[model samples]
Target chain A: MILETKNLSIGYSAKNKSKILQSSLNLKLKSGNLVSLVGPNGVGKSTLLKTLCKLIRPIEGEICIKGESLESAESNALAMVLTQGIYAHGFTVFDVVSLGRYPYTNWIGKMTAHDVQIIENAMASVHIGHLAHQSAMQLSDGEKQRMMIAKALAQETPLIILDEPTSHLDLVNKIEIIHLLHQLSRQHSKAILMVTHELDLAIQNSDEMWIMSQEGIQMGCPEDLILDGRLQRLFQSNQIVFNQDQLHFQRNHLLSKPIWMKSNSDGLAEKLSFQLLQKLGYYLEAGYKDCQLELLSNQTWQITKNNSVFQFENLAGVQDFLRNN
Target chain B: MTIRILLLSILFVVLSLLSLLTGSVWISPSEIYEALTNPQLNVVNHFIFTQLRLSKTIAAIVVGMGLPISGLMMQTLYRNPLAGPFVLGISSGASLGVALFVFAGSSLLALSPWLLSLGLGFFAILGAFLVMLLVLTVSISIRNSASLLVVGIMVGSLSTALVSVMQYYSSPQLLQRFVVWTFGSLGGIHWNEIIVMTLVVSFSIVFSFGLMKSMNALMINEDYAKGLGIKVNYLKIKMIVLSSLMAGIITAYAGPIAFIGVAIPHLARNFIHTSDHRKTLPIVLLLGSNMMLICDLISQLPGGTTVLPINSVTALFGAPIVIWIVIKNRSFLNS
Candidate 1:
């Protein structure tokens, strides 16, 4: 096990008093594992991560790293990636990554040949070797995220913790980062943990999932959590609900405005129109007389409502026409 | 980079020579050589060389090196581009010390030149240290850097207010003395005070180099630095003490030279396109020294008997460079 916490209580302490957020928690993280911590807002996910990183003191209990108490472990043995983006003005991608070697470098931080090799390998691992000399500010958000991950990799620690690593990324980049993290865990045998709001991606990519709420935390494999109904209770709201069939969350509202959907051919276009109508809060039906949508194979949508037929070149046009009618 | 360092060194040497040659009394190179090697041949030039021009040159070098380095440290410590050495009220503290000495302590001490200089430097350093101690105590309780900045500004204002009230009630002769000191001169420091300033500035700057890596980490992000096991608070306090010592001692001997502290670090960053202190530290030191020498030479007005205040000359010379660099390289703001 790379990390383990026993009966841990975390919170803030003032002059003579303390405010405890959560207590009596036992957690374990092992090598070659990718764990995603998903929780509602204000559930102390960040506070817990801070406590693990030793940024703040835990109100009670013990956190051990590699079988050693946290306070006794060598500080160089642990590494963390934070949510805050760096200014990185006038710094190249290489310079920023080289900062991860701060623990091993001398006082002046002069890089040895070994350190140089490690930095190069880190950049190559993230596929940013081409951008080694480019200013960090010029990279796209996704590229910057990769650079930060590479920085943590260069730290050469057995364990790595991240806070919302993919918070600012687009959909494709978000999945790509999670996939890369998963690969890093298995390939390098490093224990990787992250706090994220990407539930679907986390379920798909992480080896284990930690679902946290105000009541407490539940840790298990993604399938086990879903089977035991733990994932269903992760959020407390009637407007949103966990969909068992799709393995994701969806709005539980009574989908209004029943509209019949049809197409000449059962292909990508027809399936897309069907999904779109269902997503826009319309109860999708087949062969209904009152309202009808005919998605043609010629990239046009025909909507028949109240005995008036409206044709459009796209799904957006169909939505606009239906809303007006 | 090596070439730039070499060029800066050459320029510094040339400027030092020019500054030595450019005073109210026109002393040529040969005459200077004679004054140094064969002192008996030209007694007047020898006295002027060792007593006036040399001390002034060394004083300019000390202030130039000290202020910008402290300013760079301040900017890094606070993670603020606009921070300078005196932002924490060190200058104001030095001023209050001088004011109290002129307004009150003058009657208590003998009017000998040696005693006056020693007393002024001692009291100014004491005042600066006292302010630093108060700031250090307050900083222990305040975790936020912005709040520390606010506290520093408030302390500066409070000290300035006290000095103004003291000025309003002072005798005319005493007021004139205090006002002249505030105008600031690189020429007023004698050999005795110059040695102390040089030693303290050198020590502080050399010590700063040892922490350059930690400073870089802190500048990137404070919490991240903490997670890396850096003692952030200790680093901040060390920076504060070093900056105060350099600013305090220079203000005492040379009367609060300005512009160099705030502007030199920016100039280095603009020219080098990097804020890595390992790279910029040497550049800032060289540029700062050159600027001081240039400003002092301008103030002296070689052929004329009248001299301008060093404070005005630094602003007049430095402000335009800053404006030009900022306008030309607008990305400096990002750095």
Candidate 2:
């Protein structure tokens, strides 16, 4: 195991008072594995990650990195990518990324040839090599995030931790970042852990999952955790429900009357019609005698109910027709 | 980068020479060179050159090098562009210390001049240390850099007000002395005072160089710096002490020369085109020294017999540069 925490309790302590966020965290992360920590907001996911990175001291228990106590492990043993953005002005992407060599650089921080090579490799790994000359402040959020990840990669530690790496990114960028981290774990054999709100993406990409909630901590493979209903319990709410088969979340909407859906072609119009109906809180049956909906391949829709038939050119028209009827 | 550094070094030499030649005395460049090279030939000119202009030039260099570097450290520590020795009231704190001692009466002044200056230096450091402590404490509670800046301004106002109350209660002689000190003269420092100031500033600069790596890490984010294994609190305290010492010592000698601390780092960053202190620190040092020399030259008022205050000269020159930087980098500042 690259990292293991036994009976860890994480929280803030000031003066004579201490507040514990989570306790009894028995976690293990191995090389060549990507793990995601998912939990409800304020469930101490960040606290746990911070404790693991040694940014904040744990109130109780022990954290071991590569069989050594966390306190004994050098700072270069673990790399961290934080959520807070860089505030340093006028720094280029290369300058920011090269700072990862802080541990190896001399007192004046003169980068060695080997350190420069690692920096280049890191930027290339994140596909930001072309942007090395560009000022970091001018980069888009997604690009900046990738550069930050490259910095962590340049640290060349056995373990890497990221806090909400994909929080502000668009869907494509989010997938891209998670995919890059996933590849890093598999190809480089680095133990990677990320705190994320992207549940489906995390579940799909992560080899293991650490779910934190009111029930404390549950650790296992994503699939196992899903099967055991651990994820469901962690994210359960009045308005949203976790869909195990779909590997995503769906709103708990009130059900409408069931309708039969039929299509002339198994194409875009057919799939879109079913989605529209489901979104309108209607359940589709394979066939129903009293109510039937037909989607023609010519981008038309027809609804037949109780011996009446309505024809419309588009889905919106069909919705209007249904509302009038 | 090498070319830029070379150009800046050349500019620094030319400015230092110009400062030496452009005083109230009508000494030509050749005569000044001769006086510098052959000190035995002209005793009166030698006194004017060494005791007056040379000391003033060294004082400017020391103040220039010290303030900008201190400003750079404070800016990085607070992550605020406007943070500097003067803006954050560190100079004012030094002023308060000096004011208390100088206005206390003539008994202390009756002692040896060297002893008197040393006493003032000690008080200035105490005052600066107190203000640094207060600013750091307030910064802990306040996350916004701009708000901390406001707090600093408030602290400066309070110190100035305290100085004013002390001035009002003092004799006319003491009040004039305090007012002239506030005007900030570079011409009055002797070789002994300049040596002490140089030593203090050099120590701080060397200490800051050692902190370049941690400061670079800090620029990214504090948590990231910590994650990289930087001892954040230890580095912070060290920076505070170093910055205070530099600013305090310079203020004690130069009477709180303004704006160089706040402006020079920005100017250096613009010239160097990078915020990485590894590259920016040297540029800041050279540029700061150059700026101080230029300000001192302008303060001499060229054809006039009366010399202008160094503080006014620096403000007139420094404030506009700061404004231009703010305008040019509006987006970066907002970010």
Candidate 3:
């Protein structure tokens, strides 16, 4: 195991008192594993990650890194990527990544040839080699995130921890980052733990999931956690319902009357109308019998019910028609 | 990089020579060289060279190098572009020390001039250290850099107000002394004062160099620096102490010369197009000394008996550069 925490209670300490957020956290992260820590905001997901990385002292219990006590492990043995934005005004991509070699460098921080090779390899692995000469401030948010990951990779530690690494990225970039992290964990045989809100992506890519809450932390493979309904219990909310099959969330509301959705040709409008009906809690029927939503080829939607028809030019109009009816 | 260093060195030499030759006495290069090499050659020229111009030149160099380097450290520690050596009100604290000594201490204890200066230096450092402690305490609660800067400015204004009250109740002679001190003169530093300034500034600069790596890491993010095994709190305290020491001592000796601390580092970064301290430090040092020498020479108003105040000259040159930097890199303020 690269990291093992036994009965760890993590939180802040005040004058002569301690506030424990979550306790009895017994977990082991082995090499070649990608674990996603999932929890709602303020459930101590960040606290756990910080304790694991030794940023903050755990209130109780022991954390061992590579069979050694976490306090005794050299910082160079673990690499971390934080969510804070880099304000390196005039630093190039390579200059930022080379900082990861700080632990091994001399007091002056002069890079050796071996260190240079490692930095280059890290940039190449993250597919930012072309941006090595570009200033870090000039890169997009996604590119800057990759550069930070490359810095962590250059550290060459056995374990890596990232805090909300995908929070600032767009949809495609978010998937790309998760995929890259998954590949890094497997290919490099490094234990990677990330605190993430991307539940669907984490479930799809993570080898294991750490579900944190007020009760405690539950660790298992994502599929197993889902099978045991642990994931749903972790994310339980009044207005939001987690869809197990679709691996997403939907609004929970009263079901409307069934609507028979029909179209002469299946296209974007038909698919969109079906989605809208589903969102409105109206079940779709195959044949047009009682009520029907017909999508025409000329960018028009017609809703017929009880021998009356309503027309809509757009999705918003369709939503209005459904609400009125 | 070598070429840039070479050009800056040449500029430094030119400014130093100009400073030496362009004093009120108007000694030529040959005469100045003769006096520098052999003090017995010309009594008047030798006295002018050794006593006046040389000490002033050294003072300018020390203040120049010390202020900007400390300023760079401050900027990195706070991760704010507007941060400078005086951001924590160290100079105002030092000014309060000077005021208390010149106005109150002089009346309470009838001391010699030497002892008075000694007491002034001691009180200045003490006042600065006290203010540093206060700033550090406030900074612990205030996490935002911008808010901390406002706190610093408020502290400075409070100190200045207190000093003004002291001046209002002081004797005419002591008030005149304090006002002249506020004008800030490089030419007033004695050789012994320069020697002390050199020792303190050198120690602080060397300590700053030791922190260069951590400063580079800190520029990215503080938590990132900690993850890299840097003792972040220790580094922060050390930087604050060193920066305060430099700012306080310079203010005690030369009065609070403004703008160089805030302006020179920006100039260095702009020239090199890099914030890497390893690359920027040397350039900042060279440019800082060069700029100070130029400012000092300008203040001398060569060939004229009258001299302009050093602070005015520095501000005249320094303020515009800072405004230009702000305009050029407006994004930095947002960041």
- Point to the candidate with the largest TM-score: 2
Cα lDDT tens digits, model 3, B61-111, are 999999898788878876777777566687788899888878884564577
Evaluating just chain A, the predictions reach TM-scores of: 0.92, 0.94, 0.91
Docking class of 3: medium
Off by over 4 Å in 1: A256-264, A280-314, A317-321, B86-89, B111-119, B126-157, B321-335
- Candidate 2: where is the Cα deviation over 4 Å? A242-245, A285-290, B29-41, B329-335
The residue pairs found clashing in candidate 1 are: none
What candidate 3 gets wrong by more than 4 Å, as runs, is: A237-249, A261-273, A285-288, A293-304, A308-325, B36-41, B107-118, B143-147, B329-335
**Per-prediction CA RMSD (Å):** 3.2, 2.0, 2.9
As a whole number from 0 to 100, the lDDT of residue B235 in candidate 3 is 89
Task: Residues A1-325, candidate 1: write the lDDT tens digits.
Answer: 9899999999899999998888887999999999999998888899999999999999999999989999977767677888887866667889888888988888999999999999999999889999999998789999998998898899899999999989889998998999999999998999999999998899999999988887778999988998888887887678888877678887775678788987786577876786777777788767787898887665888888889888899888877776667
lDDT for A107 in candidate 1 is 91
Supply DockQ values for each candidate.
Answer: 0.63, 0.82, 0.73
Candidate 1's TM-score reads 0.91
The true-versus-predicted C-alpha distance at residue A6 of model 3, in Å, is 1.6
Q: How far off is residue B230 in model 3, in Å?
A: 0.3
Ranking by TM-score: 2, 3, 1
Better of 2 and 3 by DockQ: 2
In candidate 3, residue B317 scores what lDDT? 89
